[model samples]
Target: MSKLLEINNLCVDYVSPNGIARAVNNVSISIAEGETLGIAGESGCGKSTLAFAISRLHKAPALISEGEILYKGQDVLKMNDKALREFRWNEVSVVFQSAMNSLNPVITIGEQLTDVMLAHKKVTPKQAYEKAAELLQTVGIHPDRLSAFPHQLSGGMRQRVVIAVALALEPKLIIMDEPTTALDVVVEREILNELYDLKAKFGFSILFISHDLSLMGEIADRIGVMYAGNMIELGEAKTVFSEPQHPYTQGLISSFPTIHGPKERLYGIPGNPVNLLQIPQGCNFQARCSHCFEPCTEHEPVLKTIAPEHHVSCHLV
Candidate 1:
């Protein structure tokens, strides 16, 4: 379980005319080889920003203000154009949130998949197309669909195509940013099951990003909870889900209904998420937290280890 990717003191900011918004603030985490690490948080919590930063895909207005992203001991931030080009897809691939937007509407699925291979690897057109068809089959899509356009396929099938594209180069780490968010529950389940099987077969690590904690519990070996650009809790999936430490983490878990447990009133965290541009001092969850004390309002808590492989950031902890 060697460290495949390590992010240290990462800080991402969005600079605009109005002000700078700290999208990811001093967040640090690591993913082991062949492991699946899930990041759970609501929208605007910087989960997607972190994923984009990992791949150096953050465009204008988005800047990496601080920190290091090390992939197998190499600094991703310092990579030159040529090195970065080789690093993406070859070493890492990203499955974006939307399948429809990710793919080219006009380009045939076969061409899109082959184009990725052709761009990265030294392969003949015939060979690239052959690999493309094989990849489609691997993701449970028929090879015949390769000749079809993106709109010609179902939502689930389009998603499978996106997954196939990510696997085109057999990358060591795949950053899945809400890969199944667009599909129906049944389709989502089927795709996730296939994704799990693919991870086992390929032995590739995954950085799974989603707002769904229950889904994260099912697919992730470990879970990291983020709030207002900060990581509040991180631990084994089972431990974090069953015994969440941070008040925010607890609120997120309690908001979801459980099937096995006796029916109980669902509780939602009060107050809205903090504004990143004008974040207040101390804990970001202080405004929404029912357990907020004086210490929670005055001082920001750093991630403190409470148990083996479990860390929490809160004055109460």
Candidate 2:
């Protein structure tokens, strides 16, 4: 697979009156054509910040302090305004956590979908509307509901509509930030299955962001675990789940219940996640790690290759 996107040593910071908070610190990752890469971490771990930075959508106090986001060998950060406008939606689309917030409440679903097409593509009103209806149907919604407002639909339906809008321009890459977090388990499953089918049909890569490691194991070709704004472990989905190298990755896996395993009490990682505003010295997870040692407290570990396409950042490794 050819590399579709490459993010190298990307650092994102939130500059405020008080101080700067490092949200994404020297994170590097890549997505290949038609592949799905899952980023698993707790909230405030900078998963969403990385996604926003890739699309150049970070605003206000959020600043890209360092690194390069290369999409098809083109630097996204250096793109001119006209190029940036064309890059979004046409090349990459984002499905945010909340579908309600992503959509316009007053606009009909059909209109919203058509609006995206109209804004980016050269199409007639009739053609755009027809495409909108087709997109709704493609996502398992009835075309009739295209005329309904966002509030008129169920949570799952609204999410599907959001996905339909993301697929409006047939983007090469889709960044889904907890796209199914708001739906029930059953609805979430259905949506994920449909999303897999859509990806297969469209041949587009996906950067799936979620706190659910189990869900990531199901759909991701590879997984990267983040903690306190740093990537601690990255490997194939199966390897990461079966043989997690970092203590944080192991803790995250043990916290979830498994269907095949014997019944056991779920264990949560001890200690709270590190504060981004004032991160402690050495390993960010050393405070919570039972395996912490003198080196873990004194020296931060860089990512070391454990195997081809597998890496872990830990002194123990």
Candidate 3:
């Protein structure tokens, strides 16, 4: 596959009373065309911050302090306002964690979808409606419900509608921030299954951010684990699942339960996520990592390839 998005030592900072908060610190990752890459970590781990930075969605308080976000060889940080407006919806879209709330309660679902298409695609009402209906159908919702209000739909239905609106522009890339966080397990499974089918049909790439490593391993072609604004590991999903090299990755894997397997004590990595405003000197995960040695506490390790396509950022690895 070809590289669709390449991020090089990307850093994001927020201006606060205490000074700068390093939300994303020297992070580098890539997603290929037609690939599904998963970003796994707990809340406040900078996973969503990475996604927002990729799309240039961060506000004034937050700034891209360093590095480049390259989309198809073009620097995303340099796109002009008009180009960014065109780039956002048509080329890259986002299905946010609370995206269901993005649906306007007062407007009919069809109108909301139509507005997006009209703004981005220069389409007429009829054409936009046709496309909207097709999008709704793709997510297994009835086309007629496009005329209904948001409250008229169930939580799952509303979320699916939000997804329909996201696919309205037929974007080449999408950033999904815990898209199934609000759904039940059954509904989450269904949505993920639908997402997989959609990826096959549309041939689009996804940068999926979530705390659920197990669910991500089930669908993502590649997985990257993040901790305290740093990427600790990156590799094929199966490889990371079977033999996670980084101690942080191993601890994360052990935290989840597996069906049809003998139960073991799940040791949630000790200590809270490192505060960006006051990060530790060395490795961010050093406080929680069990295999931390002297070098781990004194020096930060760069990501090194352990196995084929498996990168781990740890002294032991």
lDDT tens readout by residue for model 3, 1-317: 88999999999988888989887888999999999999998889888778888999988888899999998998999999988888898899999888998888999988998899988887888999899988999998999998899999988999999888889899999899999999999999999899989999999999999999998889899999998888989999999999998888888899998755698888788888877877776787888877878987788888998777999898886
Q: Report, for every candidate in turn, its global Cα lDDT versus the true structure.
A: 0.93, 0.93, 0.89
Residue 106 lDDT, candidate 2, scale 0-100: 94
Sort the candidates on TM-score, descending order: 2, 1, 3
Cα lDDT tens digits, model 1, 16-72, are 998999999999999999999999998899999999999999997999999999999
Which residue segments of model 1 deviate by more than 4 Å? Answer: none
TM-score of each: 0.98, 0.98, 0.97
Select the stronger candidate by TM-score from 2 and 3.
2
**Model 2: per-residue lDDT, tens digit, 158-182?**
9999999999999999999999998
| TM-score comparison, 1 vs 3, better candidate | 1
